[model samples]
Each structure stands twice: as C-alpha cells, then as structure tokens.
Target chain A: MPAQTIVPVEANLINALEDRGLRKTSARSAVTTRIETASGAFTAEQLCRDLPEVGRATVYRTIRHLVDAGALCKLPMLDGAPKYSVARNEHHHHTICSRCGAVEEFRHSTVERVMRSLEKEIDGDIVGHRMEIFITCSNCLAESNRGGSSGR
Target chain B: MPAQTIVPVEANLINALEDRGLRKTSARSAVTTRIETASGAFTAEQLCRDLPEVGRATVYRTIRHLVDAGALCKLPMLDGAPKYSVARNEHHHHTICSRCGAVEEFRHSTVERVMRSLEKEIDGDIVGHRMEIFITCSNCLAESNRGGSSGR
Candidate 1:
C-alpha cells in the first residue's frame, strides 16, 4: 500500500494543549511528531522503545494529553492492549484482520445516521463511539486454503 | 433500570466444552455458574476476588476456554482491562457511560444489515463485529447539572 499522507495535525494538537493552558514542552512536541509520522496504530511501549530519550512517564503523560485533546484515538486489541492512532477530524470505523492484525479505516453515512437516532432512543448524549470488525485477511485465508484443515 | 433477565446459557457452555472433548471439572462448573448469574460484564481479577475457592490459574484457564468455545464475549474496557460477559446466541452491542461506568446493551436490525453489506464491500468474511458507544449516563448528567461548573 502507498504511504498515507500525514495531514500535519500537530499544529492543531499543539493549539489544543495551549487552549488547556498547557505549555508546549519538548517531550510533548516529540510525542506529537511520532504520532503524526506513524504509519498505523502504535502502543506506548513501542513509542518508548523507539524514542529512548523520551522517558516512559513523559511518553505516557503526553499520550494522555493528546487523548484528552481528542487528537488521538485508542483502539483496543483483542488481548486488551490498546493501540493509539491519530484521531482524524472526520468520523470513521476500523476493520481489523484477526490473523495479521492489520487495520483499515472506513466510513459509512448510514452508521452515522443510526448513531444519531440511537442517541434519542437511549436518552443519553453520545460522546464517542468505537466499531471494529474482525476478519481473516485474504492472504491468511489463501494460505489456510492451501494448507487445508491443518491451517488455522 | 430493571434487572436484565438472565438467560440461562450455562447449558450451552457446558455442551460446548463437551463438544471439545473437555472433561466437566468442578472448577469449570463454578466458573460457568458465576458467569450465568452475573448481572453484567466482569473481569478475571473480579472473578478471582469473588470466588476465592477457584484458583487464579483455574479462573484464567476457564475464561480462555469459555472464550474459545464462544460461550463468553470479551468486552474491552476503556482502561484496557477486558471484561467478559456471557455470549448469547444472538448478536448485540453495548453502550457504556464514560462517567459512571454503566453499560447498556441494545440491538438494531439496521446495524446488522449494514454489517452484512460491509462484508461484501470489503470482500472478506466478517467473522465478528464489536460496537460500543460512550456517553454520560442520565444520573451523571443530572449530578453535573446540580453541581454547576464545579461538576466534572
């Protein structure tokens, strides 16, 4: 797949921090850069490993800041470990490969409409949503077929 | 809210175990019973805390067994700790309160229809799907209103 153009959301993230009266620290800037340049979802541990100079506490704090600012979205893995991705301004959902752990983003107007209708039905102000569909990717399916019943 | 009618799916759980040629151990029976009687989602730690008689290892193993057998569905909590609930035969989704930690289950045929359509669009078999909406519960909203700007 071609590289997804990173829509430089770092400026927006920095402004959000400033709005909350937070100082623009170097650690926060580094974390935002990493999040922006990331190809896909990443974990805090991965961030720490990749940026050894950034202390674990700083990484976590920056992550919390970004998440609170709505600049990052958390995607929960099957094993309960959450992966963080850039929170695009536009709403979308994820389709994850159960076997290969690849995530693809998609949006549907119908789902959005249904969610709006559900807010009235449930009598609560819907703040956020998470939707993920798990499937075996085509490559994994092909390999399983080739291996017959022995393949999982 | 009125208590949700506990559908007795324990029998199906046991049958699933039997189908896998697993023995009907007392530990499994206890875990199944606890799950059947649960009012909502529970974590493995909670289960171990509630059922001290069941060893921690036994609790984890039984949870894995039930999950593999499709007798339980693991819901990912916002904090990354997963909570397991009895997996009913039919499909459903949950709406969770971000403030008070309340969970509400709901089903919509429109959502189901869209999922089926998505499978064709993606050109992949949809094995499973998860949908969760995060909102502030009515009581929390009321409390926030009563406390004015001081309320979180």
Candidate 2:
C-alpha cells in the first residue's frame, strides 16, 4: 500500500481564526483542534457530543466558519446528512469505508482525464465535479476473509 | 447529440402504491401525480407549495415513501439541502446547471470504466459511487454568448 500523505489544513487554530477574521475564543480553539486532528469524516452532532465542555452553538458556529474559510470539506452522503472532514489543499476525491467509517483521499490521472474529456460531449460548460466512492476498506475486507463477522 | 431516454420507475402512482402495500389515499395520489409530472428536481417544500390542498405532513410522508419505493432519486447538493427527482430506472449521473438550476441526467461509459478500474488500485471493496457535475447548461451558455447576462 502506498503511504497516505495526510496534510494539515491549518497548523493551529489561531492562524485559521486570524485568516477568517474570526475572534479567538477558547471554545473555538477546542473545536478547531478536534476538527484538525479528526481521523475520519464527522458530523456536527458528533463534534458536539465529543466536546461537552463547549456549547453546542459555539461548535456549530465554529464549524460553519471553518467551512466558509475552506478549512473543512463537506461530503454529501446518499442517505442521510452530510459529513465534514479536515480539508486538504490539493485536489482529490474521497473513498469512504462503509464498515469502519474511514475516509481516504485519492487522485488518478485517468479519472481526471475522463472528466476533462466530457467537456466536448456534454451539453454544458463544466465548471466543477464531485465524485465519492463507497466501499468496504481493505482492513474490513481482510477481516471478512478471515471469518471475522464482528463489524458486520 | 443523442436523444436522452428517461424510463419511468413506476408506470403509475396506483401501481407504485400497490407494490409497496401502501393504501392509496387521495392525498398520496395528488402528491404522486405532482411528482411524476414534475419537470425538474424539487424539494419537499416545493411539493407542498404546489399542492396547497394537501397537508404538509402528507407531502413529506409521500415523498419519503416514494424514495423508499425507488420511485424518486434524492440528490445531495454542495452547500444546501438535498433535492429529489423522479427516478429513472436506468443508471446515470446528473449534470446540474448552476445558472438556471436545471438538473439533467446523462450516462457516459468511459466514466464508468474509470470508476470500475479504481477497484484494482484502491484498498477497498467497491460498493457504489456517485458523481454530480456542476455546469452552465447549453441554453445558459448560449444566452451568455449572446451578451445576455440576465441570469448572472
């Protein structure tokens, strides 16, 4: 497996607050930290649950600010509400693990080429595109192969 | 340009209700007719507005039932709530017009080929995927080219 290059969107919460012209507050600081260090995509409700010390309103506001600041990426799910993840500066797509809820970023030249090629055929001026793939991650696949049905 | 083919998910509301074992209420009939004849994607609120005689609760419940019955397709937007379109039996992707808010369905084999190819490289068992392209539709593009900046 290739090494996953996880890049931090913001080095610290303070710089992000300054960039967005948002006031520095303890509640915002805690929420920013939690978001930056999140291992996978999460919902605002999950963040509220994780940070009982911070007011729910504060957490939601900080999340909105970060999203507007382009520090977080919001993914649209097929069934329920959207999820947010720490944003990466580079262009890429997401692969979500159905079993363990892991999100991985990937980019392939062929996929991009196909997207760009659509410009000539499609009846529109293509401004942007989003693609999300749902999968059972390799870890889960391996576990299933080994007769482990716990996660299922 | 190739002609777009849209096959209906259910021939009629009565059949759809029958398949789901849902009682064919008058309110459900009204909502189902409105949905089946809709020209584009719409929200539950839009349906409620269109069907002023039907109760809001009935419209919402009917939409949920149709979605579950595979009669409507729910599309997730980037920054706002998701919208629903009449379901087409065939597999396809959506191209949304940013200027006019029109949603068009299309299918490209090369795009599907690229998606399937990802399974060999990615660390996951591919289950499903979604792709939504944002564009200025041909009509919008033509209007823009004609020095009509009204939509802008």
TM-score of each model, paired residue for residue: 0.78, 0.84
lDDT per residue for candidate 1 within A52-116, as digits (tens), equals 88999999988888888877777878784688877775678887888767667778787888887
Cα displacement (Å) at residue A25, model 2: 3.7
Judge candidate 2 against the unseen true structure and give its global Cα lDDT, from 0 to 1.
0.81
* Pairs with steric clashes in candidate 2: none
lDDT of 1 by residue, B1-152 (tens): 55576545447776677678899989888887787777777889999988999999999998898888877888888684687877664678887888877777778887888887787677466788899989888878988889976655
Show model 2 residue runs off by greater than 4 Å. Answer: A1-14, A143-149, B1-14, B142-149
What lDDT is reached at residue A52 by model 2? Answer: 100
The residue ranges of model 1 lying beyond 4 angstroms of the native Cα positions read A1-10, A119-127, A135-152, B1-10, B119-127, B135-152
Model 2 / residue A61 / CA error / Å? 2.2
Rounded to one decimal, what is candidate 1's iRMSD? 1.4
**Candidate models: Cα lDDT each:** 0.80, 0.81
Local lDDT at B121 for model 1:
73
lDDT by residue for model 2 (B15-118), tens: 66768898988898888888777788998888899999999998888888887887777888876767888767467888999888788888899988998789
